[model samples]
Target: MMRGLPAFFAVLLAALLVSPTSARAEGPLVLAAASLQDVMVALADDWAARGCERPVLSFAGTQAIARQAAAGAPADIFISADRQWMDYLQKGDHLQADSRHILARNRLVIVAGEDGAWLGDPAAFLNAVEGRPLAVADTESVPAGRYAKAALTKMGVWNRVEGDLARTENVRAALALVERGAAPYGIVYQTDARASKAVRIAGRFAPRAHAPIVYPAALLKTASHEDAAPFLDFLTSPRAQAIFRRYGFAPAANDR
Candidate 1:
């Protein structure tokens, strides 16, 4: 049995602010990157309206979710903020290879807490944080963190700031740290900066700073529900893609 749009949104909208692990995630499941939370909710809503059974959406760090899928967490669809995680799943035979597609794209940016300032120059901005910690995801596994580290390492500032990081489980948690003024700044997706009223854009990283940022989506081989296919198709449809663009996301090919 499928849930309806209004009911699902009512539950999911509230969970958007809650911790991902604690989220009441039920599914033919869709494990998504934390940064995609807002638009995925909209896409889910639209899917429900179209008479598709609602997907149970579990949001987490790309690595975290990928590990879950690799360890055999039950999911029908997986959307990763970076292609590497998707590849990780494919290598493990966790995905339905034919269903894989690049769904959207985004770029990285530096952000300040509501009380923090955007100084506009990369070197100067890094200097301003001084000895204070900057919020970031886990660089080794989290794509946002990896991109952040890449950008900083390229600028020759990683040596100075590496020990000063306040790492979070995911990008959104890093956003929360900055939003609440607990961290002086954070490296996050431009779209994440747009989603929060508590944070403001300080500067953007050049596309050359890191590997291309892509949101690759795919179906898992273990899904039990028929609803997963319709929801997956809705993701790249004009209607869903428009919702993505409205939130500052680009089509995946834009990065190329």
Candidate 2:
């Protein structure tokens, strides 16, 4: 009877292993990025509904993503808000050399919470908010934070208010600090600010304040998916571009 039981269990295991649905369960295409969270989540859900495998995403500062991918994380794609970090990974031989492409552009804006003090003029804006905590991503790792610091410095206010700056891990974290009233103001991408109704945009920094904001996406060399090429094609499709536009990202220019 014990011998018969072993044979029955083996048959059951074989049946389960051979089941088409069980064998064909699709795994996710893992994506790493910070700014692409909202749009990517929506797109992934839509793609899933259309029979495409839903993508799993990990959002953080671009530097963090670069380090993880460089350390051999199982990331299928890496989308960075800046080219420098992507270049860093590429130079380290962590990315598929040919798969890189600029995917989108963004704008920088200063946002004040609904309950916060008003920022009238650019100069008065700095003065009125003196001594108050202002959130920004870590300048060392986040492009948005670096741009914010550059803009403030260009306006001759960065040094004056340097002590009031509250650094967060990423653009999203900076936005959260503002949204939750932990900080009265925050500097984040226009799209990041637009994603939250809790904050009102004080103003957009002039474009001359910093380099243009651009986003680049690429498939990593270590990606496990066989459909990586098709996925890249899907990312550049008009449908995906429209999704980016709806989320406040500008179309990638010819040079991007």
lDDT of 2 at 75: 64
Whole-structure CA lDDT of model 1: 0.82
Error of 1 at 119 (Å): 3.3
lDDT of 1 by residue, 28-143 (tens): 67889999999888887777777666567778899977876775565678899998898888989888858887889898999996667765775687677759989999988899
Model 1 residue 110 lDDT? 90
Assess each prediction's global lDDT (C-alpha) against the native.
Answer: 0.82, 0.77
Q: State TM-scores per candidate.
A: 0.87, 0.85
Q: List the residue pairs that clash in candidate 1.
A: none
C-alpha RMSD between model 2 and the true structure: 9.4
Report the Cα lDDT for residue 157, model 1.
85
Off by over 4 Å in 2: 1-28, 117-120
**CA RMSD of each candidate after superposition:** 6.9, 9.4
lDDT, candidate 2, 1-256, per-residue tens: 6766665555334423422343443534444467778887776666667777656556778877777677666667888888888888889998876788777899988888886655656777777666999899987678888888888888888888889989988899999998998888888999988899899888778888898888888888878776566666677888888888998889987553
